[model samples]
Every structure is written in structure tokens, then in C-alpha cells.
Target: MEIGNLNDYFKFFVALVAVVNPVGAIPVFINLTANQGIKARNATASIAALSVGIILMVVLFTGEAILRFFGISVGSFRVGGGILILLMAIAMLNAKMSNIRQTKEEELDSTERDSVAVVPLATPLLAGPGAISAVILHAQRHDSTLHYLYLSLAVVALTAITGLLLFLAPLISQWLGKTGINIVTRLMGLVMAAMGVEFIAHGLKQLFPILGAS
Candidate 1:
């Protein structure tokens, strides 16, 4: 494999990590599952992680098709998605969850829901719009089955790490504390903002070839 391919893989993974911000979700996870027993909590974590994996995998494979069906070009999507991610990054920088991921109503609804695993935790929290857009953009990078398989593995590995963190949410929360979590979240936000800018720049180049000529 070319070194550039390896680098792309690494970049893709880092972008996903930043967009997902699994560690940042710990506080929300803890609060959502607070009333549950250890076994229940673990189950919730597993389901959430699995849901994330499945959701991303589906998006990785079919996202392009969906975009095409809507007559949307990748360049246009990158600009739009980049803006969404940039907004989320701004929120992250402030150590706050973006309403784009989950709205105030959703957060309130999550508390009363019977199963928070698939709804708020897995959908918007762990695999929200930013995460989905990141996956779709990466999917557009290569159109090979092997490449898709490799990306799939990366998704699986990421979700596994996320699951482990969620399963150990209490310990992580205690260790990091609120201040530490906020610190980490802010760092992630910085990374995410860079990624968003990169996406928008690349997209603009694609959309307006004149930009690339310069």
C-alpha cells in the first residue's frame, strides 16, 4: 500500500474521532444511564456502540448514492457539511453540545425515553450530522471495494473504542472530571475546526476549478 493511502486512513480516523467526540459524550451517557444498574448500563453502552457502527457503515456505503439521488454533488455537500461541522466545532470549543446534534427538545425527550441507546445516544450524540458528513466525504475519496472494506474496519474499530469508553463511563468521568472533560472537548474542537476548514477549502476548489488554478 502507498504511504499516502496509509496517511489518508489515519486522517480519516482522526477526523471521525474528532467529529464523534466519544469522550465528550461521557457526561451525557452517565446522566442518561444513571438510574440503570451496572448490567443495564453496559447493555446500553453496547447497543449504542453497535448502533453507531451500523449507522456509519450504512452511511459509508450508501451515502454517495443518496447524495446522487438528490442530485447533489460532492462538492456542494462538502461545503454544506463543512459548515455544519464547523458549527459543531464552535460548540465543542465552548464545551457545549451542539443543537445540530440534539436539540433542547430532544435532550428533554431523551430523559423520558425508555431506550436512550438508539435514539439520542447513538443517533445524534455519537453519530450525528457531523459524523455522517465526515463519513460521506471520506467515502467519496475512493471507490474501491477494498477501500470501503478498510473504511468499514476503521468504523468498527472506532465504535469498539467508543463502546469501551462508554462501558467505563463512570471511571472515565471520575478520572477526567468536568474540567478535564471540557479541556479535552475543547482540544477536539480545535482539531474539528481544522478539519472543517480543510473540507470547505477542498470543496471550493472542486466547485470552482479557478480556485485550484491559483
Candidate 2:
């Protein structure tokens, strides 16, 4: 690729990173592996990254079929994703605890011990519905196979880098401090909510001719 094309891909990668908000996930990772040793924490991070990467690749490659299997149009998916993003924003804005927080209760309630990697860390935390939807939408926006490949690779690379960063959760948390983390989370929440609304509005305009005409 030419320098210009590479720059474009870089921009796309950056946007995906922002949407994924891996840094925002650091706190969640810390909480999830609070009891684990360093080796366990590292293993959990590796598993989480691999799991998330696989999910995104699957969504990118087969999202259309997956949606069709459920009889869902892209427009419908966008609307649903918008609602989810909005809810996440509301939780962030209100400083409400996430479902990952509830995992602690589940741990206390259950005798079947599970690896933290598979539960709150990997599922709803890393490859959550919002992230999956974003990946699908990103894939849909690409027209060329080359572009898709570039974007897909970029997404994976960015995700992996983010996961690696999160592996240093203790250092990051200390660097950000409590108040700084809260501020960053709220800012990201606002941005995510806006992005969600924009996706919904764009989908509505595309799917509904009357709305577009108006």
C-alpha cells in the first residue's frame, strides 16, 4: 500500500480502537482477576484477547449470514446496537456498576469454579454485543476486499495491543488514579452514545425513504 493508503488504514484502526475502548476495559480486567497471580492474570489477558479477536473476525466474515439467519436487517441491527450503546452510556454516565460487577455475586453463589478468562472477562466484558456490532458495521462499510483485509488486520492488531496494555492494569490504574479514570470513562461514554445515535440515524435515513426525504 502507498503511504496515503496506509494512513487511511491507520485512521480506521484508530477509530476502531476508540470504539473498542480497550483502555476503558482495564478497570474491568483488574476487577475480574483481582484474586489471580501475575501468571494467571497474564493468561487471562491472553485468553481474552484471543477470544475477542476470533469473535470479531467471525463477525466480519459472516455477519451478513448471521443477521439473515435471525431475519434481521442491517437497519434493525443498527437500531438494536444503538439502544445497547445508549444503555452503556447511561451506565457510564451514572457511574453504575456493570454486569461484570455482578459476577462477584455469582462467584460467591457457585461451587463450580470457572476461569475468569471465560466469564465476565471474555464474554460480555471483551467481546460484548456492542463490540460485535461495531465490528460488523465496520466490515459492512468496506467495499473492496483489500480494504476489508487491511481493516480486519488493523482491528486485530489494535485489539491485541489494547489487551497487552490492559495486562499492565496495576500500573495503569495507578497512573490514571481514581478520579482520572472516572473522567475518562464518562468522556468515552458520551462519545459512544453519540456514535450510537449517529449509527441509528444513518441507518434510519438509509432504510426509510420518507425519513430520508424529510
**Where is the poorest 10-residue window by lDDT in model 2?**
95-104
List candidate 2 stretches off by more than 4 Å: 1-15, 97-112
Q: For candidate 1, lDDT tens digit of each residue in 91-135?
A: 999999999999999999999988899999999999999999999
Give me the overall lDDT of model 1: 0.93
TM-scores, all models, native as reference: 0.97, 0.83
Q: What is the C-alpha lDDT of each candidate?
A: 0.93, 0.71
Model number with the top lDDT: 1
Candidate 2 CA-lDDT value: 0.71
Highest TM-score scorer? 1
Pairs of residues clashing in candidate 1: none
